[model samples]
Target: AQSVAQPEDQVNVAEGNPLTVKCTYSVSGNPYLFWYVQYPNRGLQFLLKYITGDNLVKGSYGFEAEFNKSQTSFHLKKPSALVSDSALYFCAVRDRADYKLSFGAGTTVTVRA
Candidate 1:
């Protein structure tokens, strides 16, 4: 089984400041981690993914994540946040041998101007 956790329920940051959404996972085998953001009434948008290759993975919306095997963490980070970046963020993970993807409860981010 695979599961993901976003310890924080909400993250508040000022515009132009760095933003981070923490995530940790547990899996039976190797894990495939992913980050998604959802705006109000919108579907989840892919932010980043860590399947293989380098430890650092970059994806849409100027977001990046680092895959830490030892700690089983893949926290999302943005160098600077924009007011428009406010949304609900999700951390998901799937065991390499499993077909199901388990997602966290989600963390809401509010970027204030």
Candidate 2:
């Protein structure tokens, strides 16, 4: 079984500052981790993924994530924050055997101008 945990319910960041959203996962074998973002009244958009190779993977919108095998974590990061970056972020872990992604509860980010 695979599961994802996003410890924070909400994250608050100011414009121009670096931001991070923590995530952890559990899976049988090598985990296929992913990050997604959802805007108000819209579907979830794929942000990034860690299917294989490098532990650090870059994604859309100046976002990146570090895959830690030991800690079983994949934390999301951004160099600079923007007010428009505020959205609902999610961490998902794909079931290796099934190829279905199981998402976390989601973390809401509010970037103040």
Candidate 3:
């Protein structure tokens, strides 16, 4: 079985400061990791993915994630966060053997000016 965990329930950051959302996963084999963000009353939007290749993957909205195989982690990071970056973030993982995806409980990010 595959599962993802967001250790922090919430993360707070100020405008123009670095923001990070922690995530770790466990899978039977190699995993397909993904990060998604959802704003109020909106569906989850794909932020980035680590399907293969580089250890660092960049995605929408100036976000990027580093895939650490040994640590089983794929934390999302933004060098400078904006007030608009505040949202609910999710970390998901899918095993190559399965079609379903397992998601974390979600972490809420609050960015203030």
C-alpha TM-score for every candidate:
0.98, 0.97, 0.99
Ranking by lDDT: 3, 1, 2
lDDT tens readout by residue for model 2, 1-113: 88999999999999999999999999987778999999999999999999899999999999999999999999999999999999999999986677688899999999999
Lowest-scoring 10 consecutive residues by lDDT in candidate 2?
A: 94-103
Which one wins by TM-score: 1 or 3?
Answer: 3
Please tell me which predicted candidate would have the highest TM-score against the true structure. 3
Off by over 4 Å in 1: none
In candidate 1, what residue range of length 10 has the lowest lDDT sum? 44-53
Judged by lDDT against the true structure, how good is candidate 1? 0.94
Cα lDDT of candidate 3 equals 0.97
Better of 2 and 3 by TM-score: 3
Candidate 3 global Cα RMSD: 0.5
Compose the digit string of candidate 1's lDDT tens values, residues 16-108. 999999999999899889999999999998888998999999999799998999999999999999999999999999998888999999999
lDDT tens digits by residue: candidate 3, 1-113:
99999999999999999999999999999999999999999999999999999999999999999999999999999999999999999999999889999999999999999
For candidate 3, the TM-score is 0.99
**Clashes found in each candidate (C-alpha, N, C closer than 3 A):** 0, 0, 0
Show where candidate 3 strays beyond 4 Å.
none
